[model samples]
Every structure is written in C-alpha cells, then in structure tokens.
Target: MADYPVTQGTHGPIYHICPGLRVNLNDDGNWELMLRTTDKRKRSSFGKGEEAFKKAIKAGELLALKLGLLQVEHDKERLLSEVAAEWLNLNRQRWSGTTHERYSQVVRDYINPKLGFLPLSRINRAKVREALTETAKIRAAKSVELVHATLSGIFNEAIDLGYTNENPSAGLLKKILPPKRKRNLTKPDPFSLKDRDLMLEAAYKHLPGSYPLILETIAFTGMRLGECLAMRREHLDLTNNQYFICESIRRDVIGSPKTGDRLIDLPEYLTKKLGAHITRMREEALAGAAFTDFLFPGIQQNAVRLMLKRACYAAKLRSRSPHDLRHTYASSLLMAHYSPVYVQKQLGHHSISMTCDVYGHWIPGEGKKNLDETLAGQPVSRRPALEVVDKKIPLVAASGTKSGTIY
Candidate 1:
C-alpha cells in the first residue's frame, strides 16, 4: 500500500502535495498547485491501498474540482426554457393526459411567448411580475395566477436539479383584485322533489330506458359525468350494494380520475338503481340478440348532454350541465347536515379543506351557529345579590306614633 500524507483543513483532513509542481494562486493566500504527470482518469479516494493509490487520489480530486467548476459555469448560462422542457419531460410519465395537455397549453400560450428566449440568469423577480401582470390583463385573474404557478413549478425543478441556485419565482405573490363570488350554478337544476318528478316523467315520455337511468344516477350519487359514463358490468357489485371506480370514461377514452387514485362507495339507493339499470340493459341486450358490457353503452357524451338539455327544457326548468348535478349532490349533502369529512371522502377529494372550499357556502349559516353552539356548551356559574327598599312617613300623621318620623 502506498501512503499519502494528510494535511489538516478547516473542517477535515485533505491530501498534502509536494511543492515540486504548482499552478495559479487560488482564492486562499497560498498558491494552488497540482501534480503535472498524475493520471486524472485512474484517480480513487484511497490514498494508502497500493503503489498507484496516492497518485490516483490526487488525480481524481483535481478532475472532480474542474468538473464542478465547469458545471457551475454551465448552470449560469442555462436558459429557463431549456430547463423547463427537461423538467416537464422528466415528469411527463407521472402526469395524466389532461394535466399534461393543460401544462403544455400553458407553456405554449403563456410561458414560451414571454420567457422562452431569456436565459435563466436574466429572469429576475421584476420580469416575472411584469409577465404575470400582463397575462392578467389578457386573461382572468385566476388563470393568470395559474400560469404563474405553472411557470414557478418549472423553475423550482431547475433549482432541485442543480441547474439554478434559487427559484426566481418563489416569493412573487399574485396581484389579484377581489373577485365577486357567484351563486351555486346547480341551483337551476330540476333535481327538487317536484321538479325531479316532472323531469323524470318528461324523460320517460321522450327518452329511452338507458338515458333516464344514466341521468338519474348522476343526480342521485353526485358522481362525475365521466365516472357515470365509464361504468362497466364488472365495476358494480349489485349484491354488496357498492361500486369500485377504478376507471372513468372521458371523451371515448377509458381513463382514471382527474385528481387520480381514488375509490368511491355508492349509497344504497344508487346501488339499487344501478342494479335495476343493469337488469333493464340485460333484458334489452337479450331481446335484441346483442351483448354489451357497458352500463351506458352506444351513446356519445354529446348525446347525453343533448338529452339532459331536452329534459330540462320540457320540464319547464332552466338548463343545467351534467357537472352541475355533482354540485347539486354536494349541496344536498351539506343541506342534509352530513359531516364534511364523510362528504369529502365520498367525493374523493384530496382534503377536507378542498371539500370545504367547494361546498362550504352551502352549509347554511353554520359559521355563526357553530360559534354560538360552542359557547353555549361551556358551563358557567350564576350569582344573585340582595336588595333593600326605603319608605317615608306622611307629615300629617307626625303626632301619631306610627306615622311620625322619629327625631
């Protein structure tokens, strides 16, 4: 084993070299030196393992330092657009099609147009703020904010990959004016007791069997439009009264959820309705000498939309989109006084906060009532104080012992 002398540094021991060979002076007061003939390729960390060990360790350390310096310089020259493309490609497999499509759209429509040609070093906080505000002028404030987030996330990836030291978009806050909140979009839906009956009657009179069942299931269960459309015979467990939502049908593609990775449980009423629909579907299939696996097969989503429109129109109700039925479900749950946590899980929301954000308003004067109720539940002590009254005697009966004031 060849031994290499170890010299003490500020924190640890580093290899000591002879003064026979020297390079340019480093940041330290002493001269930066190197061994001229050492094979940088054969370098290793061991300084005392064999005859070649000392020379190898020295070569490796020098080569590694040179590479690190080169990387730092390269990072300084890297552009934001280049880093962003690399980041998106790295994460593409983990993202869903809709999500990836949306991100690509943002990059093409917003990010590239403004920041594509600019180097990462040149993109400062002020430039980002300007770009964000410009977008807000063209689009809705929320949309601008979303683009800001998308761009920030891309830059953040660059930081993580060692292409940048800091994320320039990290601390920039969105400059949004207060927005006016709107009433529930589902309020016009004919899902009320009377309206639903009328709508059902109209649907049965005009539409075929499968259509009515499809619409009713969406309204009843608050399942997403795609989830209801994608159901197969295998997905439903009629005997157990539950269905597993492993896949959804969106625009002809059998896919997963937008939020992704969730299994929703169906209520008993929905389970029975689904069972009945499956039975009716089987009867139709057998009578027509045809077999199908889909619960709502042989219909496009656009056709379903049209049917819903016609039903709402014939029932003398305002037209509401299918997604609104999901909102109606959420509102109904809150109005029925169901726990937010239960509803959140049923809806496959990532968090209770998200459920609250969407359905919090429908909770019906709950905030103040909750506060009052909490105060009322606490015990408090009560106290009473004694009181005295004074009466004056009449002056006319001053001579009388009972009426006279004593001197």
Candidate 2:
C-alpha cells in the first residue's frame, strides 16, 4: 500500500484506504468513507479497518457500475427478490404483524413466484401485464389487486435505491383487466332492535355465561370486540356509564387501541348490566374463582366470533360476526338522528368522513320516523334450513348526510 498526500475537507484530512476507497477521520472521531470514481462523490460513516474496507469495496462497486467505469452485470443478474428482501427489512418496523403477514403472503404466494427470479430490468410492462393476467384467472379481483400493489411497491423501492431505473408495474393497473367479483363488504349489516333482542335471548340459552350481556354492551357502546375483550377493572366507570379504551387485543397480542385512548359512553341500561356483571365476577373471585387480568379474560376473538355464530343460529337470524355489533351500534345511533361527528368519536374512527363512508347508508331517508324499519322487516317467510345463502348485496352510493347534524 502506498501513502498518499492528505486532502483537506472542513471535517478533516482524507486518506487512501484502497484503490477506489478513501477514509476521513472526521472531527467527531468517526471514520467517514469516501468512494472515488467518475464524477459522483459518495460519503458515509462506517467504523474503521477491515469492515470499513469491505463496505467501501461494495459501495465502490456500485459507484463504478453507476458511473460507467465497470459494466453493470445484467447477464450475471440482480433478481428483484434480492431488492424485495431489502425493502421488507428496511420497512419492517413500520408495518404491524397482521400487515406484515399479509404483505409477506402476497409476496411469497403471488409476486415472488412469477417475478422473483427475473432481473429487475427485465420485468417490463409486457411481462407484468402477462403475469397479472395469469393471476387474474385464478384469484379474486381484490387479491389480484393486492398482487399488483405489492409489485408496484417493490419496484418503487428498488428504483429509489437505483437498483433499477423504471417501474414496469407502474400505470399498468388501468390496463390489467382482472376478474370481476363481489366486494366482501358492500355495506355495514347492522341488526335491528328486534333482532338484537332475539339474539340476546338465544345467547342466554345457547352461549356460556356473560356473552349475552357482552353482545348487548358491544351493540350499545360501539366498542370494537377486541377493545371490549381487553377491558380491565380499572377501565370501567360505573358512575358515568362509560369505559376508557386504553388498549386493544389483536391476534392475541395486547397493544394500544386503534384510535388511541377515548372514552366510550354507554346507555344507562347497559351501564347497570355491566356493573352487575362486574359484581358477579368479583363475588366469583372471592369464592375461589381464579383472578383474571382483563374484565373479559380467558376469551379470544375467535371464541367470541364462534359464540356469536351460535347465537345467530339459535335466534334464526343471519350469521353476523362480532364486528357486526359495532355496525349495529353505529346504525342505531344514525337512524335515531345522532350526529355523524359524535358517532365518529364513539366508534373511535380517525375522522368523520370514515364513519360517514362506512355508516352513511344507515342515515335515514327523508320523512322516516324510525331507523329500525330500514334494517328490520325482512320477509317472515323462512328459507329451508341448511340452505346456502347466495344472495348478493347491493352497494349503496353515499349521498352525504341529508339533514342538519347536531354537535
């Protein structure tokens, strides 16, 4: 190795570490790596010696290829999978477990299977279009759309890092004609008061202890089932008929609530019922019942959903998930002419527009006296038992709120 004359920067003097790599011990005493190539100058901090030399060499290779000194190995291949792995790692902390799982599923099952092996440059518009077309033949429209989004995101990250120049998947969605299918949630299917009573009655007979009351509380309060399950003794306020939503349980993991902390007010009837339930739990604990961490401890979202299914069956009503009770609460208020803004706060939605977008259909038509008429009044004729329900729901276009809203 040959010693070179020191070059001066405001930080410190620069010294040669290798052929294309130089090092500067900055005023902060940190080793700064400077890659010397054509016209571009790249500087980064890496700890000293052999590790710095390796990183500098790797960076130097990229700089050389970028500056046209060394030919970029198109024939040797830089697969998109390589860039994708880096992208996922880079943004792993930003995504939740459910989100990470979904993104991983799309990548592993759809995107990687078709485009993983291809060089990033080779994944042109035609190739992407063909791949989407093939996938559309097998998957639903929404699933195919997710595949397209995953490809676009991967390609975007790669382009940002200079791994590839163009995003071939970009703007191809307008042209890709995926399969047409029904959307899973056309609108919120909230239960009527009569149906609520029927289900609660069936819950008393069919479900285990406290579930009947639990269902009513969810319908009355608009708290998410997860939030309800995460309730603790300290979260309750019997005097005010309300509870504080500090945390939520998702996929068996306890974390902060979706919309942060908020107070959920309940009807007086519900407040008394919950208070009585708490008294019962306390009495049970005193009589040798195991102490529980949460008010609704020893239960999971799946078990609640399964129990709700049984109650729906026994009530001779449509099978509604536990989340549907939230819809029931929101719709009940809306039809009663409650303000959407108030409902937004109660539902823990980020904004009024989201509540409106979801529950907009629940807003009563002009001159309607009771909101119950809309969700209720299903024809009394019962279909054959054990018959598959294939009826398609129609999507209602939101026309915004019709009447003046109260604060």
TM-score list, all predictions: 0.55, 0.60
Worst 10 residues of 1 by lDDT: 17-26
Best by lDDT: 2
Task: Write model 1 residue lDDT over 1-407, tens digit each, in one string.
Answer: 11235666553344443222222223342333344444332212332323334344334334533444323333457766677788779888997655666677788789876776456765787777767867867777567767878888888898888777877776564344343363122232325556766776788778875788788787777777887888888878877766777676755666687666555667788788778777877887789947678888767778888898899898888777877677777778777788889888777788999989877876667655456446866533332335544656355554655555532
> What lDDT does candidate 1 reach at residue 166?
73
TM-score of model number 2: 0.60
* Clash list (residue pairs), candidate 1: none
- The top-ranked prediction according to TM-score is 2
Please provide, for model 2 over 1-407, each residue's C-alpha lDDT reduced to its tens digit, 9 standing for 90 to 100.
11334678776666653456566766776666677656557788776665564454445434544454433334455777778788788878897654666677888888776667556765688878878988978876677789889889888898888887888988887676523443342345778989988998899898997677778778789988878988887888888888899887766677777777998887888888877888888899999998775778767778888889999999999999888899988888888888888999999999999988788866748346544554565432432347665765454447653544333
Q: List the residue pairs that clash in candidate 2.
A: none
**Each prediction's Cα lDDT score?**
0.66, 0.75
